[model samples]
Target: MEQANIQMTEPGVSRADLAKLLAQALGNEKASDVVQKAASKLGIRRDPLDKGQALSVLEQIAQTPGLVGITARFAKSRLHLR
Candidate 1:
């Protein structure tokens, strides 16, 4: 499988949006837990409302084992590294 290459941009979905989407995709209960786990691993606070912080959380999730399968669609076309 190909790895996702997400990019940061001004007119893209925010971290909160991404979290909510992930939650919906993974079912309600697992969503928050997943976000928390990803955030903790990324050294970001467990607040989905902060976009910048949430990006770090997403990055961490992207690096995790089996996470690519869970969040591949979300990871697509959303992140751009400098």
Candidate 2:
């Protein structure tokens, strides 16, 4: 399969919104107590993430031996890089 390039920036999706989406997708709240729990469960950093950062983090995680399959399922067109 050919590789797809994902841009970290989107013209319509705000950075904060992307962060929130990822949090929800992983079963967490945005900038709330539940975020800590959800992040810990996912074994990712607990720091607040903006849209671009969230994309970068996701890309890195997708490269892991077991994470790509699961992450790919979350790659929707509305949020994909152009």
Residue-level lDDT tens digits of model 2 in 1-82 = 9989977653443434544544544433432333343345556563555445455544544444443324423643334553
Local distance difference test values of all predictions, in order = 0.57, 0.44
Model 1 Cα lDDT, one tens digit per residue, 1-82: 9989999655544455655656655665666566667666666654333545556666666665574444734653354331
lDDT of 1 at 55: 62
For model 2, where is the 10-residue window of minimal lDDT? 29-38
Best by TM-score: 1
- Tell me the lDDT of model 2 at 81: 54
TM-score of each: 0.51, 0.32
